[model samples]
Target: MLPKFPMSRQCPYHPPAGYAALKKEGPLARVRLYDGRTAWAVTGYAETRQLLVDPRLSSDRSRPDFPVLVPRMAAAKLVALVGMDPPEHDVQRRMLIPSFTVKRVNSLRPAIRRIVVERIEALLDGGRREADLVPEFALPVPSTVICELLGVPYGDHEFFEEQTRRMLMATSTADEAAAAGGALNRYFDELIETKLAEPGEGLLDELIVDRLGPGELTRLELASIAMFLLVAGHETTANMIGLSVLTLLEHPEQLARLRADERVAAGAVEELLRFLSVADELQRVAAADIEIGGQVIRAGDAVYLPNAAANRAPEVFPEPDTLDVGRGTRHHLAFGYGIHQCIGQNLARAELEIALYELAVRLPGLRLAEPVEQLGTKPGGSVQGILRLPVVW
Candidate 1:
């Protein structure tokens, strides 16, 4: 049984400083998880890429030795997205991929642009010269987009937003995250029933009634997909928007360069991803005994491949710590490499490009409302997000 401790400390990847330590330790080191098991943490760029690409590394957490972020129950639900080994993961991912394709997501650009404009207008109208970019701008963009994509009614997102926030907040205890997960599952169960009754063009509608036909996904599977989109699609982009916004505001010179040339925004987004790297590590268990970096990972051993660390590795990126947006270093693995590379990469790119470009262009004279360290933050999750990035224009 796992020891009872705060979930905040149990997170295998927390402070970026850990990566510096791992660099000195030759790429891999042991760390404890919420389940109280010590597992190998991979930080080197080459090793991280190998671990993610290796067929021998299983994303399944069902193994007894799997060192998970939350408790067994919560981790099980969280891993539903590309978390399982081949066959099953492939099937589920295939069903979900088309909805997030560049073509489909691009169709929603009008809606996304409308959403961004409305939110910015509201923020401006509120008359607060300084506001938290997170709750006001960063959180709403992705939340609205994901809800719109999944066919979730805008009115119904209150519960989902709350539950997803709890689950994504790394500081939440295992029980807390699990409870949030359960609530989200229940919400999806009801939402799926609604989608079943009224088939629409969105992903949920097609998955249940149209694409899958009858009995393709049981009630549980339907609910699982709904919850998966809620968390997976919403939280990560929200954090990135906030981090990217803060990053640009902090470095005005780069922001000016990006504003001067729209062509540079794409490269800037990639560099920001490599620098901030909010998506952290992807965890897996060894399917069979495999050797990585001369260290043997026995079957059933848990592994964490920290993409954030690897993206900043000195070996792959020259001057890894500095944010050189125009370096044109697009080869970074901020998104996990190999088959499980994020299906929503294009959508994420579009959102980041739109958000960053619009802010730089419209919110002229934008500056930090407070000192960098003074910004409020919640810790312990896969993404390190600012709670309140106060800013002034």
Candidate 2:
């Protein structure tokens, strides 16, 4: 029997139990997806890296055979950089790359630090013995930063958060996801019009005055890019923040280590990113015939690259399941590989380092308010994260 795609994880920190056996089977194997579609699931680290940069593979979601994780995702149009193919993808990605470059992100470090510190202070000021870290701290830091950077009103965070949640839920119906996407598109449309009228000192305004004003990009495409940044910039990082804290609390020794030395904090972030592998699956399609792992991926064949499994591959990292903060995880596929890798990774690293560092220093007594098993996980989606993390200090 073909194993089902997105096999459920028995533990939040580990890949689905079936993944170990799957990796043992081979580098690649066919799996059945939600809509009764069969696709190739790549589990080997080497193969994942090879295909990630292969020109024969396409990230274009408009392809009929593109591996859609959910019916809702299938119904949605592909207007963002994440779903575009070369030439178009290159052009679009280049336009936004300047804002995410290391130099630019580093320049924002002071602001990000201020946001993290403010959020931590707010949590402390609540005067409560216990608080849900997800909302009080984890979500706010990145959300506020992204809003300021994009010139979007942070007051509308609740609305966009809800819409993004619906759009990404694997079980959401086509209509539900479409409605959520529509809401976000409309919001961006209005925001773009506002920016056009009176420029602000945000990334969106820069794009409008520079790129859009020069007719370098269409209004629709600009809005779509802004929407992508707003969603991707905050959602993944927020989830990572919450999940990272929980993981550290569970591993007290590592937590102590991180607390003891700030120098090792950067390495700890990479290790956690590797171990968690939050975005479990990266979807793609075969644009042309390609031979990999002694198998032919025919044109139009759907492909599912489960990065979580690849990150845990023994060949890449000895004792892959173990979380060692000192482990060299620079080559890990958590942010993915090749040209389509996360553009916001630099900013993500900075945010995580600052957040974790501040959490350690400010709340040295931090502990889970409830049992680890009692914590809820997001039901089904590309991103893997905790529903809520209650903690006490």
Candidate 3:
């Protein structure tokens, strides 16, 4: 029997144990899927990068034969810009690029810092010794930042957050996930309707005034894109913050280094991104027969590129299991490679760097309330993170 695709990590800090074994087999190893079908898992760093940028691989989720790793993935509405190929993907990404450019992210640094400080303060109120960082700090900080960024009413965070949660839950049935996705789309639909009457200063309003109103993009497309931004703009960052804190706490010496020198923050965050690699495999279907890494992936074959495995490839990162904050890792696939790579990479980088530095410095006395093995995680979705990070100082 072939190794199954979508293996879960035995430790939140590591990729799935099966991934290492798969890598041992070859770069393009055959894997079994949940639906009794077979797919190719690109486990080697070089092959993963090669496939990620190969134009022969299609990201469109609309194809009838598209691979469904989980039930939730069947709901194509959740894959706006990511589920696109060239021309459409290029156009949509260019439109959203202005909002996430380096200059724009630098402008948001102060606001991100303020948000992190406020969350830290909340965790420290009345000299409290402990709080579940996921709810108290990790989740809310990015959720609030993204809410303000997208012009969504912050008061309704719980609604959309829950919907996004259900939508991304791997345990969700196809119908259940569709419902959750529909709720978010409808919410964005109505929100766009509201903005149509009176615009705001956020990204959604900019699209409404420029793209939506002019019919350059349709209501459905705009709403789908908005939902994507709302869910992605925050969820991934929130998870990264949670995982980074846990990683640093486990490595006290590294934690001390991060706290002592603010200069190391950028490099440390990049290494953390490389170390954590919270995202799931980047999925695509072969558009044509393509030969790479001595294997031929035929047209319509499902290809899974697990970045977690690639990030830890011993060939690329010597001592890959060890987390070195000063490695200055610039080539890791924490953000997917090629033209379809993460659009908000700049914003996400800023958020992680600020949050980790602030939390380490503000709570230098921080320690895990429980053993790392005992902590529960919300892993195996489109993203991976702890469900709660109980900590004390």
Candidate 4:
């Protein structure tokens, strides 16, 4: 029998352990998905980069052929930005490019640094030697930063965060996921109405002011974008911060290097992204019959790109399984490749660099409270992360 796709990682420190055999199968090999559908697993780093840019592959989730890696994505409506294809995708992305530019992200560094500092202080409050980093530190830093950037109130983070967890958690049934998603949509819908009445200086507010009048965007799209940004903005980065901290603790020499020299902080973040690859899956479907790696993916076939595997390809990264903080090569597909690459990558990098570096410096004695094996992974979801990262300084 073919190995199942999305095989779970037995340990949080690496990709799903089964990817080694799968990669050996070929660059584009077939794997069985949950629904018993066979999709082409793009396991080669170079092939993944080539096909991601190919126009024949579609990111559109609306298609019946789109792989439902998890039940939540099955029959779901297309998300505003990530689920689109150009020129609509291009149009939507164009609206936000200026906001995520290097200059703009750089301007937010002071504020991001301040946010990381506050989170560290919170973790250290009451002279507490131990706290769950997931809630106390990792989750809040990016949550606050993204909340401030998107103009969404950080006070309501609990509601939205729970809703997002429900939507993404693998255990959630389709109905439960649908309901959680609906709750978020309704929440954002109301928030949009509120913005209409009392404008705030958020990205959503700017969209409402600038685009709604020109027929350039709709209130619904605004809500979807808000939901997407809020969820994507925090959950992924939060997990990254938690996992990156755990990783650094596991590799003291690398951690010490980062703390000793601030210059390595930026590259360290990149290495962490490549090494951890917390976002384990990036799925696409063939729009037409396409060929790569001596294989043909039929039209309407799903192509699963486990960047987790691709990032670990030995040919791409020497000793692919080993973690190297100084291996800051930007060649990995962690943020993805092609026109659909992550728009918020710069912000994520800034957030990770600030969060990781600050923790290393402030909590020099930081160590994991629980045995690595005793820790729980994020319940089934496309995103790979530790459920609760317990730590003490």
TM-score of each: 0.91, 0.98, 0.98, 0.98
CA RMSD per model (angstroms): 3.4, 1.1, 1.1, 1.1
List, residue by residue over 117-229, the lDDT tens digit for candidate 3: 99899888898999988888888998999988889999999998899888877788888888988898899999989888887889999999889878899999999999999
Off by over 4 Å in 2: none
Candidate 2 per-residue C-alpha lDDT over 110-162 given as tens digits, one digit per residue, 9 for 90 to 100 = 99999999988888885867899998998889999899888999999999999
lDDT of each: 0.75, 0.88, 0.88, 0.87
| Residue 324 displacement (Å), model 3 | 0.6
Give the residue spans of candidate 3 off by over 4 A: none
> In model 2, what is the error at residue 351, expressed in angstroms?
0.6
Error of 4 at 324 (Å): 1.2
In the range 83-166, model 1's lDDT, one tens digit per residue, is 677787787888878777888878877888888888888878966577788888998898888878887887866788888767
- Candidate 1 steric clashes: 2
